[model samples]
Target: MLEFRDVDTFYGELHVLKAVNYKIEQGEIVCLLGGNACGKSTTMKTVLGVVQPKRGAVVLEGEDISRLSTAERVRRGIAPVPEARRLFPRMTVYENLMMGAYTRKDKAAIAEDLERVYELFPRVKERLAQSAGTLSGGEQQMVAMGRALMARPRLLCMDEPSMGLSPAYVEQVFEIIQEINRQGTTIFVVEQNANMALSIAHRGYVLQTGEVMLHGTASELLGNEWLQKVYLGQAEATPAPR
Candidate 1:
């Protein structure tokens, strides 16, 4: 589980996150929804130790991880599938997945995890020797998720997993995410695909200009006529969830 309490993040003194607060319970899938540049990604980066928080704490399980290094965070059971599907373009699918488990020392366990990943993403298994860059966008996203899973994270923070994908691919990715959660990993995802996110999330948080504006169960957020207009895009909102 992860918790962000009154957290503030800055991009060179231009404070982007304004006292953000949220919690992701163990084995739960929580989605953070917000418009572009509203600090959703920044909040994630802070959790990953990519950007240092200027205020408050980023807690993992029970310890304060705000001051931990990114590698340390990853070693301490945190992994992220970034928005860009951050794969090494020239690397083979198998190689990309192996890189994720570099922090671990058990070769046998690593091999076992590799097999599990292949089972989770059969496309990756079929193209084990293929260059990651040659795969389709959806396949690449699957590889990205597989790579993260190889790390064996307790809490996986995925930033915009469905960004820039076709509707079918988006559905596929979301389904895989749900399956991942069902298998026991906690997930805290940030997404622009509000309908898909709400549908899959157990709980949801709406962010506006770096502040949490609404928090509710997925069904509650989805069924609310006002939220549907504001986020489900039935009507205009203050900013683009772009």
Candidate 2:
């Protein structure tokens, strides 16, 4: 549902995301993984319209949305949960979710989606009136996801959803991500949690120094020798289905 072709991006003259090309198909979960300083996050930002590409295209379905404003992109059904769970600290959980649907005029639909978000995240529902800033890291992440889902996106872009959480929380986040995809939202996620990412992704892409270094099925990448060495610390291990 999303495509990036020959994308080159920069941050104040520091070139990043060099000629990256890939596609995220409908109802598919695709991941971008790499070490620190790689352009994985940059790739996501480019897709979200936070970082504009100097060259190439960011296409959503059939349209080339290279120059679309972020709000415009959201209206077109692209929603993102950024790296740091960006939420209104002082806003109540319910209020935070409502803000996500600000672009929509359908109150009934927004209410239904809010109900679905609560169903997906029970904790948020239980504390709907509580201040968002008071929640734990994991709870806050849930709020972030809930807010993004409020937009009812066709394609969801998640950047480091599992970051800054305990192992248990990380696993929780992954489970939710899987459930979201199973419910038919095409997901393009950038994560450092390689094991979790590759485990659930339909396909994966490895980025490095502003370029795509690897691309294949999730199982193919999970079993790659170089990938094992770089992330799992088993340099000579045999490839095995995850």
Candidate 3:
């Protein structure tokens, strides 16, 4: 559903994404794995048009959306579950979810989508009147996912969906991600937890120092000696070629 072609991005003169290339097919869950400052989040921002590429293009469903505004991208069915779940602190949970539908005017469909989100996250429904900032980290994450689903996105872009949470919550969140993908919304996840990300991803890409170092199916990545030694912590494994 989305493809990045030799994309290069920068903040002033400091290059962040260097000729990064990858693709997310419709109905597939693709995860991008990397350590700190390796340009994982920048890839997400590039997809959402928060940062434009200096070279190459960001194509969505065959269209060159390299220059499209963020709003336009959202209208075209791109929704983000931003890192840290950036919800409106003072807004009620219900109101926060409604913001996801800001670009749409189909009242009935929006209501039905709201119900769908509630079904997916009963905790959110229970806390509809509660302020978003008052929820626990896991609850907040659930709200974030529900908010993205509120948009009825065709392709959901999730950035660090497991950034901060207990181990149990992390497993729960990844399970929910798989469920979402099973329900037909393609997912592109940027995560540091390579094991968890690849465990649920159909395919995975490893990004190191702003470049894709490896791209393969999930099982192939799991069996890669280099990836195991570095990301998966199999210290005894021999290094494989980049």
Tens digits of per-residue lDDT for model 1 on 1-242? 78998998888869889998998899999999988988889878998999999999999888999999999999998998988898999999989998888788988888888888888888889998999999998999999999999999998889999987899999989999999999899999999889989889999999988889899999989888877887798775468677
The stretch of ten residues in a row with the least summed lDDT in candidate 2 is 230-239
List model 3 lDDT by residue over 1-242, tens digit each.
89999999999998999998998999999999999999999999999999999999999999999999999999999999999999999999999999999899999999999988988888889999999999999999999999999889999999999998999999999999999999999999999999999999999999999999999999999999989889997687657989
- Which candidate, 1 or 3, has the higher TM-score? 3
Per-model lDDT? 0.90, 0.91, 0.95
Give TM-scores for every candidate, taking all chains together and pairing residue i with residue i. 0.95, 0.95, 0.96
Clashes of each: 0, 1, 0
Return the top candidate by lDDT: 3
Q: Candidate 3, clashing residue pairs? A: none
- Badly placed stretches (over 4 Å) of model 1 are 236-242
Model 3 spans with C-alpha error above 4 angstroms: 236-242
lDDT of 2 by residue, 55-101 (tens): 99999998999999999999999998988898999999999998888
Better of 1 and 3 by lDDT: 3
Error of 1 at 109 (Å): 1.6
TM-score ranking from best candidate downward: 3, 2, 1
